[model samples]
Target: MKLALGPLLYYWEKQTVETFYQQALTSEADIIYLGETVCSKRRELKTRDWINLAKQLADAKKEVVLSSMALLEAPSEIKILRQICENGLFKVEANDLGAVQILAENKVPFVCGPAINCYNASVIKLLINKGMQRWVMPVELSRDWLIKILAECTQLGIREQFEVELFAHGHIPLAYSARCFTARSENKAKDDCKLCCIKYPVGRPATTQEDQQVFVLNGIQTQSGYCYNLLNDVPSMQGLVDIIRVSPSGTESFTSLQDYRAAVNGTGSPIQLASKECNGFWHKIAGFQTQQ
Candidate 1:
């Protein structure tokens, strides 16, 4: 299976983001997704910069994809989305329906990102007809769900039309909202709030009353508190998935990529799950619970 590095969900400074991708050049990642998929206000790198970065990674013999924002609330966001879709160089991952519409209208072959609520084979078929090149299964879906969907696709003879990507690692992106949760947590309004998300590299952990981490607040995106790991489940993904995606989480991103590479290559034994990691969604349980 191919290894893909998902877009950076957290906000970081320009240099930090640049440095991360620089290190990614030599990492085990076969595919690297660029662009900011969270809040557009986190403009440490603009559209031109992302396209430039994608070019650099593409030139390095790595398949590069430009990811779009999950929640777009302004015309300016649409304008930027158009620019990404029209970049004409790298594939674009459509995180929202608006992006899907734009890419479809332009007849561009695009990736249906995890944020898109594509739950059935029918949607997959429709997207394929609209020029979807790949489908990144929603993070919350289970293995059984995927098997059923792929079966349906096979029955319909559309299974071979597109590749299936699974969000195999990193924190699960649970939801996106119009409100900036990070700004609100800092007692600031969404508009006037300073760029506070950058202070917490991986996002501010939201804990339950019992002092258990339940969610991570990153700008407008809400992610699962525990990292979603599938290193032990690589064998299960053999024929079912074409690519395994690892979301960027900070300094450990490259190490996690290497670990996944080893697991995929059979160069390492099954790694034990950490206390902060879970693979419940893949096992059809509560998303934050690790299946033993």
Candidate 2:
């Protein structure tokens, strides 16, 4: 199975973002996705910068893909999405229906990102017909659900038409909203608010009254409280998944990528699940619960 580095979901300093991808040049990841997928206001890096970075990674013999924003709330966002689709040098991961439409209209083969509401084989078939070269299964879906969907695709003889990717690691992106939760948390309005999300490199953790961690607030994106890990489940993903995506959180992400690589190669010791890690979604259980 191939390892892919998913796009950065949280905002960070411009240098930090550049440094992360520079280190990724030698990481175990086979494919690297670059972009600002959450809020367009996070201008630490612009569209030109992302395309330039993608070019650098492609020159290093790594498969590079430009990711589109999950939510486009303005015409300017659509303009940026069009630029991403027209990047011609690398594949684009369509995160929303508008991106999908743009890519399809341009006759560009793209990867359907997990953010897209594609739950069944019918949608996969439709996307495949529209030049979708790969499909990243939505994070909320379970292994059983994926098996059923792939079976249906196989029955339709379109299973081999595209590759299947799984969001195997990192915090699960739960949802995206028009409101900026991070800005609101500081009693600031969405428009006049500064880029406060950059202050929290990973994301601000949200807890319940009982101090139980529930979710993470990253600008407009809400993520799972605990990291979603599947290092121990790599054996089961061998034949089913073509790419295993690990969302970059920080410097330690490269280490996690190494561990995942070792696990995939059958050269590592048994991995210990951290206290704040969960993999229940893959086992068809509560999302925040760890099966082991």
Candidate 3:
């Protein structure tokens, strides 16, 4: 299966984003997704900047896809989405239904990001008709759920029309809200907040009353506290998945990519890092629990 670098979910400086992609050019990842998929307020890299970076990565022979924000709160955000769709270079990863509608209207082939609600074959078939070239399985679905969806697709004779990508690694993105959890954590209102998300590169962590890590707060996006690792499950994906996505977290993400590549190639065992790992969602268990 091909390895893809999922879009950067955390906010980073322009220099940091540039350096990460530069390193990604030499990494084993075959596909690279660029653009901000979270809050629009995190504009470290604007639309033009993202397009320029996409051009650079495309020039280097890396398959690039521009990702859209998961939550679009205003018309300005829709304008930004239009600009990304009209770029005419790399593919676009539609994170929400509005993006899917815009892409459908433009007749642009796009990748359906995991955040998009594609739960059934009817939705899959509809998206395939609307120029969906690939679809990332929703993070909450299990392997059996995917099998059932694919089975329905097979019955409909549309299984091969699009590629299947799994959110193989990284902290699971659970939800998005109108309120910025990060800003709230800093005792600031979402509107008047001074872009506090940039301060925490990966995101601010939220723990339970027992001091047990439970969630990560990044702007309005809520992610799982534990890092979702699927290195051991690579073999299980074999022919069912076309690509495995590894979401970029921080400076350590590059090494994680290398390790994932090794695991895919059977050259190395799964790296057991210091972070808590979970694959329960993939195994049809509780999202935060480990079933392996």
Model 2 spans > 4 angstroms off: none
Estimate, for each residue in 4-62, the C-alpha lDDT of model 1 and write its tens digit: 99999989999999999998888889999999899889899999999888888888899
Model 1: ten consecutive residues of lowest lDDT: 263-272
Q: lDDT value for candidate 1? A: 0.92
**RMSD to the hidden true structure, all candidates:** 0.8, 0.7, 1.2
Off by over 4 Å in 1: none
The local distance difference test score of model 2 is: 0.93
Q: What is candidate 2's lDDT per residue for 94-183, written digit by digit as tens? A: 999999999999999999999999999999999999999999999999889989999999999999999999999999999999999999
Model 3 clashing-pair count: 0
**Model 3 misplaced stretches (Cα beyond 4 Å):** 270-275
> Candidate 3: minimum summed lDDT over ten consecutive residues — where?
268-277
Cα shift from native, residue 142, model 2 (Å): 0.9
Which pairs clash inside model 3? Answer: none
> How many clashes (backbone atoms < 3 Å, residues ≥3 apart in a chain or on different chains) does model 1 have?
0
- For each candidate, give its TM-score against the true structure: 0.98, 0.99, 0.97
lDDT of 3 by residue, 91-191 (tens): 99999999989899999999999999999999999999999999999999999999999999999999999999999889999999999999999899999
